[model samples]
Target: MNRDTLKNWQSRIDALSLRERAFLLLTAGLILGYFLYLLLIQPTWQALHQGRAELESLQTRLTALEIRSRDLASGRATPEQERLDRIAALQTQLAERESRLQARLGGILAPQQAAQLLQSILAQTRGLQLRQLHSHAGAPLFNRGSAATAAGPAVGRYNLTLEMEGGYDATRRFLQQVEQLPWTLFWDSLEYEVKDHPDAMIKLNLYTLGHS
Candidate 1:
């Protein structure tokens, strides 16, 4: 406000009685607090409420799916021939999935390749620093058929753990790059902690299946 108008308002406040000024101060404080809640706290609470609701819905769906899967496996009330037919169909689907998985993965000794690619991407990310890159021993994928045989084509899953510290945007870009790689990757887990504002520590565990 211009000087004269501001002074007029100040004089009017000065003319108020002690109890009147206290009441005005309290009213202003309440208004400020309400605005602060709207500007800062309300959105966080709304997000948390919505997230909890979604989680509950997902949990309900997951429970039903788990029950169905158990029935498929045990076939407690199913006819003997029907159970056998379901088994055959599941085995066929498994074989087809395995075939497609093999086609997507054409490399061997995947851990080293994964590490190299991750390092390259990390280097390219401006605000990210790599603290650790750990590669675990490969776990072989067994053939799923009437008979479990190792004589079939050998395939294994390579596990890699990546630890880094970076800004959120840079880490998000790095993850996107990893996802867009030519080979398929199974995401095991991801942990992100923010000890400092706008910067976070990230731990990512990933695995890929390929020739042993």
Candidate 2:
């Protein structure tokens, strides 16, 4: 080779081995590696992490919902149980009312027998010939207690006043007979007088009270 050509070749070879060139190549390689990490590896890792977080949140929500569903299922009531509860409540109320009614009636008569008490009373007095039966013009009321003294329940007292002409013994017998009334009956007053031009006849005032 010519001396000038060989010298040019040696200069080119030396330039390739220089520190500046090496530094430039290393910098370029480092930049390419950084871009690859940002574009591919970093995005993949971030997506994976995000997916994991979302899965965990979904699992937590599902567990909470399942627990709530289980609680609701356990607390659910059957139709029969609800009906029984309602029936029990009604029975308790009916029993309380029945007890109150029995107490009010003095526990004297059964349900079926209670209805016939007034009829039985009237039937007993059918044979007695009433001369002048004067029912007091007032409310039909009576006391629930004995003697019809208006001591117990005065708002429901039943008073039956009457004037009759009979013998003293017959009047006494009639008063005694009325004591067999079903509910209750008692004489409050009994006034007697001798009738004019009567063959041993007496006018009697009879006041009685009945309770039903």
Candidate 3:
């Protein structure tokens, strides 16, 4: 029937062989899969990566905050301990104040009171003749008042100067009497002059402190 037509068809079929058809189909399938991945799977993978990064950042921030909180908690001091320390410091201050008050109480004495004390001392003197007696009263160091001590009234202090003339034995007896008196007197100065008589002239300076 038509030998020419058969030959043309056969030549056309040979141009597109089975191997070429298979290769063309494979290339078309690979292109379609790449488009699908770009549209759906690639976006999903990007979103997953972003979400993982955000989660990691949040975790790191949380860890840092937790560590800071723990550090702050550890650094906190208890109120009880702080109060106890304050109490101890206050107690020490109180004790010091009390000691200072006691010392102040011990150092207080006054002048007129010292004169009366001298009279008492004279009463206790053994054999002294009441010779020419002189007394110079100085300003009182403190008024008749309480000492700085917490327990008792403050006392006052003063300086007193006294002079007397008598025998040596009588003067010694007067000094002994002064030392044995109930109150305290500081013998600041003493001067004695010898005369042709058996008796001697004596001068004395006294510092006395007394309470009101």
> Which predicted model would earn the best TM-score?
1
* Cand. 3 TM to true fold: 0.38
Tens digit per residue, CA lDDT, model 2, 87-196: 66665655554445435665233323322443344344433344554444335342132222223333333445555554555556656655554544444666666565
> Which of 2 and 3 is ahead in lDDT?
3
| Over 4 Å off, model 2 | 1-129, 136-155, 196-212
Residue 96, candidate 3: alpha-carbon lDDT: 60
Q: Candidate 2: deviation at residue 155, Å?
A: 4.1
Cα lDDT tens digits for candidate 3, 32-151: 999999999999999999999999999999998887777668964456756776766665665565445447545444455667767667666655444444555454333321222333
For candidate 2, the TM-score is 0.30
Cα lDDT listed for each candidate: 0.81, 0.54, 0.66
Lowest lDDT 10-residue stretch of candidate 2: 142-151
Comparing 1 and 2 by lDDT, which wins?
1
Model 1, residue 203: distance off in Å is 0.3
Q: For candidate 2, give the lDDT.
A: 0.54
Report backbone clashes per prediction. 0, 6, 12
Model 1: per-residue Cα lDDT over 8-94, one tens digit each: 999999999999999999999999999999999999999999999999999999998898788878756456867787887776766
